[model samples]
Target chain A: MKIGFDAMGGDHAPVETVKGAVDALSLIEGEIVLFGDELKINKELSQYKYDQKRISVVGTTEVIENDDKPVKAIKRKSDSSMVVGMKALRKREVDAFVSAGNTGALLAGSLLKVGRIKGISRPALCTIYPTMSGASVLVDAGANAECKSRNLLEFAYMGSLYAERVIGINNPKVALVNIGAEETKGTPLYIETYQMLKETDLNFVGNVEGRDVPSGKVDVIVADGFTGNIILKLTEGVSLSIVKELKNQIVKNSIGKIAGLLLKRNLGDFKKQLDYSEYGGAPLLGVNGLVVKAHGSSNAKAFMNAIKYAYIGVESNLVAEITEKIKTMPAFEAPVENEEENE
Target chain B: MKIGFDAMGGDHAPVETVKGAVDALSLIEGEIVLFGDELKINKELSQYKYDQKRISVVGTTEVIENDDKPVKAIKRKSDSSMVVGMKALRKREVDAFVSAGNTGALLAGSLLKVGRIKGISRPALCTIYPTMSGASVLVDAGANAECKSRNLLEFAYMGSLYAERVIGINNPKVALVNIGAEETKGTPLYIETYQMLKETDLNFVGNVEGRDVPSGKVDVIVADGFTGNIILKLTEGVSLSIVKELKNQIVKNSIGKIAGLLLKRNLGDFKKQLDYSEYGGAPLLGVNGLVVKAHGSSNAKAFMNAIKYAYIGVESNLVAEITEKIKTMPAFEAPVENEEENE
Candidate 1:
C-alpha cells in the first residue's frame, strides 16, 4: 500500500513534512510518495538516512499558499503539491492522500478531483476533538453550511462509521449537536434530523447540546457545517484563551513561577490533552477516495500523525465501506405532502 | 426604582438570590420585591439587616424546576415566582424584572407579559462574554432559532444599542457571526444581514468568525438564535472544562497542592476574570420592559451583579431607545435574489 503526502503543505513545509514522512515510513510498512519540489525534498532528506526503498519523491512545480482561494487556487495551480497528491490518490497510485495545506483548496480538490461517493450529496469534514473523557468526532465542521435534514443524517452515518473504525470504538454513540438536549429544541432541520437519525442503524444518542461536546457525552456529534464550525472554533478559542491566561498568571511572580515549576509535569499532560497534533488530521468523509486534511500549522509530529491516520484509513477501506453502505441504504427522501383535491 | 427578583430561581434558590438582593439593596438605592414563597424569602432574608422597608416580599406557591418544559411550566404554574415577578413588571409595579430561573421561562414570560416592541418581530437574548480585552455582547443566544435576515439585522441593531447604552461603549463595533470573515462565507441569511448592517447607522464591522468571539475582536457579535446559542454554550462548556481540569491538576500531588496554595491569590484573579458572575446576566432585548436572565447556577455575587445590570438597563431606557430607533429606521427587506439563488 502507498500513501501520498503533500510535502510542500503546512507552515513547516518540505523540511518538517519530509522528516514526518521518514518517521512515518519507519513505523508503517507502506510505500510513501512525497509530492513537492524535488530539490527541496532531496535537500531535506540528505540530513537523514532511512529505508530509501520505502520513500519516493514526486516533483510538483506550483504551491498553494494559506491565503489563496480554494477553487481558484486549485484550478490555477494544477501542478501544486496538493493537487498532484490528490491526483495520485484518484488514479489508485496511492491508498490515501494527506495535506496540511489550504483546507479550502484541499476540500475543493478532494471533491473536484477525487469526487464524491455515488450516494453522497455533499462531503462532510470530520474532526476528532480531544475531550476530557477521550476524543470525539465532529462531522461537517465547515464543509456544507446550508444542509438539509437528509444531509445531516448522512453526516451522522459517516461520522459514526469513522469513529467506530478509526477511533476504535464499538457502537459509537451518534448525536445531533442542537441548541438543547430536548427533542423539540433546535431548528426545523435539527428536529427532522433527530427523527431521521432515530431510524438509522447507528447508535443514535438523540440530541446533544454544545456544552456536552467538551464533556465527551457522545462519540460522534453531527450538525450542519455552520453550527459545527462555530462549535469547533469556539472550543478552540476558549481553550486557547484559558491556557494563555493561565500561562500569564503562572509566570507573574516568583512564587507563581515556582508553582508552575512544581506543576510542570502535570501542565505538560494538560497541554498534550489540548493539543490537536495528538490526533491526526480531519478526514473529508463521503469522498470516493480517502482524503485527510492536516492542520495548516502542523509540524513534523502532526504530519507524522496525519500519515499514520491515512494508513489506517486505507487499511480500514473507509471510503469503500462508506460508499457501499450508502448505496445499499434507502436514499434519504424529503417528506412528501399528498394534495388530494387542491388541483 | 423598583426591581423584581425571583428569589426561588437559580441553583442556590432563595438563599443566594435573597443574599444578592439584600447586598444590592444595601449598596444601591432601589426597592427589591423578592417574589417567592414569603416564608422562604423571609427565612433567607433574616440573615441580612438593612432597612426592612427597602426589601419587600411577594407570595408565590409554585416553583419551576430546571428540568421542566419552559413554556408549559410558565403557562401552568401561573403562581410561580417567575410569573409573579414578570406580572409585576407588566403592571408597572416594578421598573425591571430579574430571574435566574429556567431561561426559556424568563424569555417566554418576558414576551408574554411585556410584549415585543412595536416593529420588533422577535426578542433576542444577549449575553456578555468576558474576553481578553474585557467583554463583548453576543445576541440571539437562544431566543429565536431559524431567523430571517431581517431578524439578524434587528439583533445587530439591538445588540449595538445595548452595548452602547448599558456597556457605555460609544459606536460599538457590530459584526455578524459567521464561519468565515469573507462576505460570502456563511449561509445566505448572513450575507444578506452583512449587507443590511453595512447600510445601517451602527458601526458595522464586517464578518467575524467564531474564534474572534472570545478575542474581543468586535464589541457586538450577532447571529441567528441557533448558532448564537451553540457559540455561547460552547464557550461556557470549554471554559468550565478547562477550569475544572486545572483545579484537578493543581490538587493532584503534594508539591502541586503546596504550589496551588502559594499561587491561590493569583489563581483567584485568573478565575475571576473568566467567571460569568462578573458580567451579571443576559438581557432579553426588544421586549417592552427591561428583563435580565441570570445564570441558573448563579451565586449571591452573580445575583447582585444581575440586579446592577437590570438597574443599568432601566436607567438607560434600553427598551424605549431601541423601540423608537426601529420605528423610524427602514425595515430590513430580503434581497430580491439571494446569494444562494445564483448558486
Candidate 2:
C-alpha cells in the first residue's frame, strides 16, 4: 500500500511535508508517494536520511492556494499537487490522500474528482475534538453549511463508524449538538433528526447542550457543518484566549514570575493535551477515497501525524466499511405531508 | 426611581437578595422594593443596617422554578415573586425589575406581562460577553430559538443602543457571527441578515468567525438565539474546563503545589477578569419595561451587580430609546417576488 502526500500543501510546503513523509516511513511498511515539483521535493528530501526504495516523487507543476475558490480551483488546477494526489487515490495508485492545503479545495476535489460512496447523500468533515475526559469525533465539522434530517442521519452513521473503525472505540455513543437536551428542542430540522436517530440501532444519546460538549459524556457528536464549525472554532478561540491570559497573569509580578518558572513544565503538558498536533488531521468521510485534511499551518510533526492518520484509514478499510454501512441502511425518502394535504 | 428585586430568586434567595438591595443603597439614590414572602424578606433585611425609608417589601406566595415551563408558570403563578415583580414594572410601580430565577420564566414574564415596545416584533436576551479586549453585547442570547432577518435587524438596533447607552461605548462596532468571514457565507438566514445589515446606518463591520469572537474586534455581535446560546454556553464550558484542569495540574506535585500557592493571588485576579459577576446581568431588550436576568447561582456580589445593571438601564431611559429607534425604522413587509410571475 502507498499513501499520497501533497508535498506543495500547507504553509511550510515541501520542506515540512518531506520531513513528515520521512518521519512516517519508519512507522509504516507502505511506500510514500510525494506529489509536487520534483526539484523542490528532492531538495527537501536531501536533508533527511530515509529508505530511498520506499519513497517516490510524482512531480506536479501547479499549486492550489488557500484564497482560491474551492470548486473553481479544483476544476481549473488539475495539475496542482492536491488535485494530482486526489486523482492517484481515485485510481487506486495510492491507498489514501493527505493534504494540509486549502480545506475547501480538498473537499471540492473529494466530491468532484474522487466522488462519494453510493447511497451517501453528503460527505462530512469529521474532526477529533479534545475534551476533559477524552476526544470525541465531531462530524460535519465544516463541510455542509446547511443540512436536512437525512444528512444528519448519515453523519451519525459515518461518525460512529469512524470512532469504531479507525479510532478503535467500541459501539461509540452518538449525540446531536443542540441548544437544549430535550428530544423536542432545537429547530424543525434538529427535532426531525432527533426522531430519526432514535429509531436507529446506534447508541443515540439524546441532545447535548454546548456546555456539555467538553464534558465528554458521549463519543460522537453530530451537527450541521455551520453549527459544528462554530463549535470547533469557538472552543479553539476560548482555549487559546484563556491560556494566553493565564500566562500573562503568571508573569505579572516577582512571585508570579517565580511560580510561573516552577510550573512551566506542567503548563506545557497541559497545553499538549489541547494541542491539535496530538489529534492529527480531520478526515473528509463518505468520499469513495480516503481524504485527510491537515491544518493550514501544519508543521513537520503535524504533517507526519496526518500521514499516520491516512495509514490507519487505509489499513482499517474505512471506505469499504462505510460503503457496506450505507448499503445496509434503507434508502432516504422525503416526508410526504398527509396532514397538510387533508387541511 | 424604584427598582423591584425578586427576594426569593437565585440559589441564595432572600439572604443574597436583601444584602444586594442594601448594597445598592449607597450606590444609588433610588428605593428598592423586595418582592417575596414578607417574613423571609424581613428576616434577611434585619441583618443589614441601611436606610429604613430606602427599602421596602411587597409580599408574594408562589415561586417560579427553573424546571417549570416558561409560559405556563407565568400565566398560572400570578402571585409568584417573578410575576409580582413583572406586574409592578408593568404598572409603573417600579422603574425596573431584577431577577436571578428561571431565565425562561423571566423572559416569558417580560413579553407577556410587560409587553414589547410599539413597532418591536421580538424581545431579545442580550448579554455582555467578556473578551480579552473588553466585552461585546451578544443579542438574542437565548430569547428566540429561531429568528428571521427582521428579528436580527431589531436585535442589531437594540444591541447597538444598549452598548451606546448602558455600556457607555461611543458608536459600537456591530458584526454578525457566522461560520465564514464573507457575506455569502453561513446559512440562508445569516446571508440575508448580512445583506440587510449592510443596508443599515450602523457601523456594520461585516462578518466575524467564531475564532475572532474572543479577540474583541467588534463591540456588538448578533446571531440567532440558537447560535447565540451555543456560543454563550460553549465559551463558559471551555473556560471552566480549562481553569479546572489547570488547577488540577498545578497541585499534582510538591514543586507544583509551592508554585500554585505563590500564584494563587495572580490566578484569583485572572479568574476575576473572566468572572460573570464582574459583568452583571443580561437585559431583556425591546421590552416596554426594564428587566434584567442575573445568574441563577449568583452570590451577594453578583446580585449587587445585577441591581447596578438595572439602575443603569432605568437611568439611561433604555425603553424610551428603543421605542423611538423602532418608531423611526420602516415597518417590516415580506418581500413579494414579482419575478416569479414573469417566470
Top candidate on TM-score is 2
Encode model 1's per-residue lDDT on B168-219: one tens digit a residue: 9889999988898888888888888888888888889898887778999799
Best by DockQ: 2
Model 1 chain B scores worst on lDDT over the 10 consecutive residues at B334-343
Model 2 CA deviation exceeding 4 Å by range: A328-343, B328-343
Q: Which candidate is the best by lDDT?
A: 2
Residue A327 Cα positional deviation in candidate 1, in Å, after optimal superposition: 4.2
When only the first chain is scored, the TM-scores of the models are: 0.93, 0.95
Candidate 1 Cα errors over 4 Å, as ranges: A66-69, A72-76, A327-343, B61-79, B332-343
Per-candidate fnat, comma-separated:
0.78, 0.79
* DockQ, each predicted model: 0.70, 0.76
- Give per-residue CA lDDT, model 1, range A136-180, as digits (tens): 999998888889887887888899889988888888999989888
Model 2, docking class: medium
Q: What are the per-residue Cα lDDT tens digits for candidate 2 across B172-271?
A: 9999999988898999999999998888888899988998888788999999998899999999988888999998899999999999999999999899
